[model samples]
Target: MNAAVLRQIDPGMPAHPNELDRKRIERALGSRQRYRYVSPKVSCVTGGYHIESPCCSRNIDADGGVIDVALLHHDAASATWQVFRKDHRTGAWELHGVHQRLGSVTDVLNADPERVFWQ
Candidate 1:
């Protein structure tokens, strides 16, 4: 994915996806961490290590690009997604176990596919 597109999609670097209804876990003295991801398949993606730890940290490009979904994983202990930060600092998201793939999304079946099929 293009870096420019990534910047445009995640202008604020929000911890979770705007559409995710989940209320991520929170820890004391820290802001709550949340996870958001796009699920076209509507079920748990359980086959690839890359899915478990996406280096670019999934991002979407509603405007037009190579991505169309983004997810945020929260670290309950630190109360923030260490993965996104780690990717920013190093200019790359590592393949460590910390970049674990998130669970399945329950609201996907009910999602509004307005722009999805139009493309």
Candidate 2:
């Protein structure tokens, strides 16, 4: 995990939406609740990886309504990462955002709509 994106426990109100999203994502990532659902699958491509969690699609839980979320491979050389969501209507993986560190990836995960899947 890159130090720049590492999340710090503030124990106070988040300064912004991204902060809140990051915290929630960290919680979700550590949660065993996700294990109750199906494990997300991953695929390796020439340049990166693809991760998909089907249980998260259209599922409801304490966090929020689940939607289709994925992690698309970004730059292999730099080890950069990007998040994507499958458009329910168009069936395309739309870009959610990018992460430079491990903690930021949690923020990306938190940004995902609530569903039952675990990644």
Candidate 1 scores a C-alpha RMSD against the true structure in Å of 17.6
Q: Compose the digit string of candidate 1's lDDT tens values, residues 1-119.
A: 54346648977553333223232111110221222232232112121111122123334333333332222354534544322212332345442224333332212212314322112
Candidate 2 lDDT, 1-119, residue by residue in tens: 33234435443422222433334443455543444455444444443444455444333233544444454455535666666666655667777667776566655454444531243
lDDT of model 2 at position 88: 55
Q: Which stretches of candidate 1 lie over 4 Å from their true place?
A: 1-63, 68-71, 83-91, 94-119
**Each prediction's Cα RMSD?**
17.6, 11.9
Error of 1 at 111 (Å): 24
Model 1 lowest lDDT segment of ten? 24-33
lDDT value for model 1: 0.28
**What value of lDDT does candidate 2 attain over all alpha carbons?**
0.48
